[model samples]
Target: MTQKRDLENKDGPSAKKVNLEFKKEEIEGFFNDKIWDNKFQEEIKEQVEKSQPYRWGTITELMNDELLRNVRQEVLNEIAFKKKETDIYKVHQSGDLANLSGLDWDDLSRLPSLYKLRAGIYSEEFRDMISRITGSGKLSGVKTDMSINTYTKGCHLLTHDDVIGSRRVSFILYLPDPDKKWKPHYGGALRLFPAIVPNVPKTDYEVKLVPQFNQIAFFTVQPGLSFHDVEEVRADKHRLSIQGWFHIPQEGEPGYIPGEQEATEARSTLQQLQNKELQEYDFPKPIRNDIPADELKLYRGLGQECAFSPEEYSYLRKYLNAQYLEPKNLQRLADVFMEESLVELGGILNDELAGKLMDSIRDLEINTKAPAHSSEIHFPWKCAMPPHKQRFMYIDGKESLEASEEGIKFINRTGPQELPNFQLTGKAATNTVEELFCQICSFFKSIAFRKWLLFLTRLIPTSDQILLRRFRPGSDFILATSTDSKLARDNTDEINALLEATFNFTPTATNSKNWESGEFGGYELCMSSNASDDEDEEDDPAIYRESDPNDDSVLYTSQCKWNSLCLMLRDPSILKFVKYVSVNAKGSRWDISCQWNVESSDKDDEDEDAATS
Candidate 1:
């Protein structure tokens, strides 16, 4: 018997005029009768198990011939002129995936015709049949979200579940070919994975469903278990489908409460899992250890040790752009420094102005240094030292100075004339805390000292770069101005006040501390919420918990030192002989270091000898 005729006549009983009231009763009766049928229940259970994803597929012939033809023509027309990007359309609805709804519905429009086709498939009669077969009662108020998905040869969708807010059932109506089967090799097969766990599963078990014209597939969104993906299309063909959901109706409708509750529970569980995963991957490794050896070698080749080649210059011009100044401009600056005395004079001028001119120069619009000519130049310019080998130094900024037998060589460029000189300095000294602080102060006051300190700190041998600490056993706390104290507490307003009072410069606190230090010399830094602390923790909820002293953890020691140095640098009222300074502490012990390279324009010929002495 025809499906339509069977629905009209029940149990061989027929009437001249079918009552609309009787139709509702008939539909409800059909659903109730199938609710407990042992064979039907077994069919569903077997399908859910054998399919492994609780989905079903069926092909309906000539559902609506003329509408189908028009829709096919429209899809072809859209694809022929489509841009090289993904496009989507939605039927109107409100919720998390609301972008998939509220499409314009004029019959003459191509999209509205597609929408009508979707509405027909999700019609009251069809939904009632689905509800009866699935043992879900009295289906009414079903809404479908339909869209045409055209996947080019390279396009594919990554795995995701159709589960969304208030979605009960998900279905896809296929329109591929009216005469031929949509084969697996075409690479648009619907792939489904059985749920073993939330967000993670054993990938050995999976199933594939190839499409045929007028075929439909439906499944329940079983939270994380129902993972699916669209296989990338291999052939130059369009895979069109009207995808949608069967939703529970608004309040006062039957069967609405149960469906709503099911959706709520599923969404809540998914969100909890998402939050937990986010916290796990927050802090990445500090060192670039994961980079491959070949890549690292390539990066090292780009250092300052190598001379710039034509190709390198071209690349720098293209990639680094405006940062690379014209060769003529560099020559002009070089010509101004023709006299050796000018180099020394510039250093003396910097000392006379103390910090004022240095601060102004730093803030000046002109580009003082040439663009790094090659990767060889990068080593000398490495501003922040690695966590290991971080310590204080003092030296003269004389470019011609020779290295000691310990391989500590100093090449100074105290004046702006010559290229920035560097030295290969040996290990740091194990001086007393007071002596180290004194050296730090002297280094900041002397231009020659600044040059040597800058080079030595950056050139420590890789093997000897063991992390160091200055520990004081008795004293557990250090004293500083209220400004410095507020920084440790992360008070922005106080930090700004300190900056203004010291350097006469102000910057917004958008950039956080780049490095941090803790007990036993642990150090690391990056833009992330996760970092280790050294001090003891209290019950204050506003402050982050401190690191455990007993347990060894790497703290961002450089960040702590940089913060101290930045505070000192901001004060233009102080000496300007140094370009950088940092402090390191463990327990009560602390070491402060300063570094600067001179600009030649500030020195005089007579001052050169005194400066070197």
Candidate 2:
């Protein structure tokens, strides 16, 4: 046994004897200068654009008899034992072919020849040339970090964008069929797509490329729309490639600045936008009915204003009655309004308030069941238009005659006895009655509610104001409006009180028509403040406060699945009620108009021309 072991050890090859005969200087020149020629660059670019998703090729000259044998052996020895996922040891295969990745020397590895080649390719001269050609200062002198995936018979990668992180450019160096041309029928074709939008594009727009040895393909990562997928291999052949990036390197590189400050700032802004609360848009639905009794009560009374301290509103003499109005005490009220388990309400509050709230809800239900009064109409006043456009109307029992260009018109309503019109010159008309009320409460706390009462006086004509009435399904349609200026001053307080009172006595049912009309389908909450006619028109009145159709000024609006709920006041003077107005919208995935700027008008005009032509 000892003699056999000695003989085996003597015959075994030493580690040093297996070192690669890689010509570092030669390989570096190939990547840095020789690989990218005018004809080759044009061909690759055309192929990438033609391919629906991605296109890549490899350099054939480097995959020669001596170099290929030595490189393959070194790869199998040095990389096979290392962590497979690391940058240095990547195994790539498409069909039967496979190769190791990341042999660059400037990285952690000490392979002298490989290091020399990597340095040469990433040298200043090469990067400058690239910068001149691509017109991107961001890519000059970029270092690449990449990993490889080996594919067998059924192994395939689905279509996806390689846009994650800060990848500026992507390229693949082919090593398959050193002598033979990689034909289109071979199945390992790189595909690219023309971007229709940033992320989504026409699926049929695609191009393909059949790679050859000693060839490479590169392209920019166009976020959103640049999507590509690998086609499955049909034949049993191995395809190999060296894929890498031209990174915007750390500190010492040409584009690198003191601390990467700009990149950091951009990332922070993106995160903030992503974390903001979804605005309630169209439908108004209860968002937090499951809160604890006390908490719910507080939230119900204060709305979003609960976030502020009482000290903030000390200027106004109103103190929150925590006992009755705080969120903690409102759970019972919420449950009752929701028509949920009565037993649960009893556990949260003494049977007293719970029973009272429930009774009020039941009363509202009873009123709803009574024969439709001559004045009452369904909640949603109009059907929505496909793509963009929503309409809502309310009719009350009271009647008012208005002199228009046509003639005197008598309008009926039941909600308020008068339309509370305050001369709000720059204010958004679509701001919800509740949101305006909250702002008033927050800002005018120091000033007596009566002092602010004067503002609403200028809003509407005295004759029109008298036409307002309380919203009554049976007798009121357009006749109801608010005449009390003082009550209007504390709009937030008044609206909350009204809502609480309404919830106490009214039980709102899930409108069957609402469900059948596809109102709740695909609903999602979103917010927009731009004064776009298309967007404003798409809002549902039940959830959105209808703004003055004539007002084209910009105003912030929150939307939910049901409708849009907007806060009209922009004055800093009325900031007090900021938290009080909590707009609720139903949860549904509804389509929203993407028109936000004046550019959409051009598109509209073009569309009109097309139709006319």
Candidate 3:
């Protein structure tokens, strides 16, 4: 284990000289002399200008080596870090550095190197240099923003463009072990993603930078173009770094433009809606296809009668537990579901099928290596796109991979032809994990199971989609988001909520404690939604309120488990997310997720009784 150290009590040699004031001449001494070289400056500017995906650049030996080393030492010794986990990120972080200017004498003396480092970073001369290289216009030194983070194994940040508020430039200075070189496989690379248009980030990162000690990476805060993430730290080593942003020029600063910040905020609000065309760019779009008339007629005819035919029972018995199929048990479960609009069944699958599934999944997990890159993932399994919203590998019953715009259009188009037919695929299943999951998908979509579902929930299925998802460790997650407005709209005559179910099949040894601790993520969480109607200042849809674990807003949290199913009726006000699977997880989070547009089974009966009267 790594030994812990506290902040040094002794002041450094420059501690007495350093104060809250910034001097132009002093800046040159703080940074490497190469930074002031005309040739180096021009080359860096050119690099930023020609960079792909977005304008960005990196500088090696960014600061005075000794000074930065001391800064790193002081940070590790003095600052206490709190573990922060949210929909988009998970890491240990120190408090905001914006208050460094007001620190009392004792505190200031203790963090002299840190204070000096901060001053050097936000000095007028340094900000001007950054402004020129990135061509992002003048930045305000007064509004200094910075935070120190130590991303040990399992820490990660999901894809997002840094477009919040008045941020003009986003930069990170690496402070990992100065003596050793950081390697690519260590997994703390800064990955940059290219966008399909402006707001939609591609499914995978095209470029990544593995930072070394004293290296700094910075980019202009383009609203949609500057999409990036910190790849999960796969190695058991501390990856220390300082993250900060240079803000737009403030009222008293040079190059200050009145109302510029407000205009940017307004534009950001417009971008959030993404317009209708942009919505098309999102993969596995929220648009649920309407059910066919024949299925609708069948479901309506079965109203109030939860009875299953012998043939239907036989078919369902192959997948579901025998007890679940018994009429008394079904009615008892239905009573519970009806009262709460939710139910979780343990050992949901029959012993024969469940044992086989657990074995196959375990074999696949232990014997076969999971794909590390998006490109390495093969068909039947496609990577989810527009990764800022979600990042996971899924089998959505599509025969061919469809990631292009034309492909999205074809899949999302109105028609029963585009609807998934997992049964057809299950016919060819070879008992592999993929085939077995496909079979599970088919079971959920089966008409016989729909009748069993009607008994369990008293809801008539209108339309459905079933997905087999694999949340791989260190790579996949779904951020907090609510049901699509179109599907969740409150209509007295129509469905107000969607019936959802998740069949968890994460294989784990009985004694393993990783999944239960919630330390390795891969949990499904649902919270009361805080989405607002105000366009100009909508709440951040991705982050939970500072992500307090004890907050009552979290309605449910289901850990990765084996042979369990969770059923719930989700309205528009509910937010859900699959936490990012940590690299330390025992295995991938395997599950079959099913969704349906459903109406109350009693609705048709009431209509018929009124007509008869």
Candidate 4:
């Protein structure tokens, strides 16, 4: 109320205008004089043209400091922000600032400074200046767009190129604590990533800009190339900013073209779904190599037996809960899985192994430092590539390799081997986490475990790939994606599906106070792909749908838990993702994930048929 009272007298009569319009002559009055300087404008143009990774530029003291400060105050006091989280981002965002012009007098009166700020930003003078600096051509004054966002501790926007419909420029005007310097350690920097090709972003960011109050960062929206992400906020402070985009001129505006917007949309990142060539650039592709002949034969033979052997029981007892080994319990599990196609088992590991794992993970979280940077991640661990889709640390039981243009192409063309082996880590595998994870991976891949899985699911695995993964707090996640279409092609004998299993070893207590309610993220979610309808198939598969509670689209929600295992039969139509871990999480979401191409079992189907009769 005091800020509003102060603003009422600051601009007097002009502030009450129903349709606020910025005059060309008043440019210097609304923005910093430095931006209007011709020499400064040319320097900015040059800097943007030569910017590394991609074309981008920044302006410090971009707006009239006093006016912008007043606007920030108005935004903080008058605007109501709602927290929204999806697979791609998490932030508290105010409703679109573009609607400020439509507000009634009573509502408008509450945010005069914010209204003035929006008008000044979309003013013809400022738009021209931005256009010239970024060489993004003409920008429309009519199609104004903006929203205010506050990135408090744990909030983030993951890697994305600002390419949708007719967007020419993207900018963020920072409004943090004006008097204090925004530190790099606070972890709210705007990071830019290089692309291996057009659509594939590199595993690591190549550049970052730590923003301060009144500093505006802007870039030309290059399809697939201009990739960037907002690093997660780690400090208990608001990193507030007004984010907006300048679109190509609309009809009746200067430089408007009849079909330019359509042309731009045609080239958007979403179009990659229809382009098979671009799909090759994606990393950790759903390339599940065919199972080795001998291995397949062994599993098929074991599937005929109803129970485990003495040798098999001894091998499994080293890792599995004793109760799960009981024939009656195993039969019950198989029956449940056959009916529902999925099951979640808690206390999955034996007491000794589980205790050792929990202790090692808790120690890693409390004492040893986690790798916050890609370069710091060493042996037995590798960072997943192409940050636009996923970011996490994993051991795929192979030699660690950097993602290069040649490497991406090589893997795409030749295809990698079917099974993973942890022997590549050698001496480096001695660390408790690595050692335990390797044993787990090996256990999942072992013939003994395959036999157990066969009796439990009545499906024979034809191929397998196992990974020991750590989704670190604030820095890792896999965006929602469906199983690869290739899974269906792996086997011609019967209807094939991916028999997937995740053994969670996250040390966080699963109570509501910690991770159970999903506030701190680190949840693995599975949903119906919704790809059945012909109309829905055209929708971008990567976009997260806000499912209605009554809808059956959400198949399962697995919160971060300690010593639990989730088993599911995944067809190509099931979508899944691990939610981005918040900085507030107790530790990383630790798990060994296993995937196998499984042939449907006629035996289980007949048993169900008989029971129903």
Higher-ranked by TM-score: 1 or 4: 4
Cα-based TM-score, every candidate? 0.38, 0.34, 0.90, 0.89
Give lDDT tens digits, candidate 4, residues 1-613: 3432222123333434376566676655888988989999999999999998999999999999999999888888877777867777888887667777766576677887788888888988899899999998999998877888899988888888878877899999999999999999898899999988888888788999998999999999998899998989999999999998998999998999999988988987666534678677664555555667897777655544467779988999999999998888888999999999998899999999999988888887898878988889886788886687788998887766657888766665665643557654534685787888787777877788887888888888777778788998878999877766766563265455788898888877655578887778888888777623355333321253444323577788888888999899988778888888987787788988888877765646677899999
RMSD of 4: 4.8
lDDT of 4 at 360: 82
Q: For residues 121-202, write the lDDT of model 1, one tens digit per residue.
A: 4557566656654444444464444445555454444345655555556676677877677778787777776543354322
Candidate 2 wrong stretches, greater than 4 Å: 1-73, 76-78, 81-117, 138-143, 257-613
Tell me which of candidates 2 and 4 scores higher on lDDT. Answer: 4
> Model 4, residue 414: displacement in angstroms?
6.5
After superposition, the stretches of candidate 4 with alpha carbons farther than 4 Å from their true spots are 1-17, 273-275, 292-305, 365-367, 410-419, 423-428, 510-512, 531-552, 603-613
Better of 3 and 4 by lDDT: 3
* Candidates arranged by TM-score, highest first: 3, 4, 1, 2
- lDDT per residue as tens, model 3, 330-367: 88888899888889998999999989888898888888
lDDT for position 143 in model 2: 46
| Ranking, lDDT, top scorer first | 3, 4, 1, 2
Clashes of 3: 3
The reply for model 1, stretches above 4 Å from the true place, is 1-46, 55-70, 74-116, 135-142, 203-205, 258-273, 277-613
Poorest 10 consecutive residues by lDDT, candidate 3: 3-12
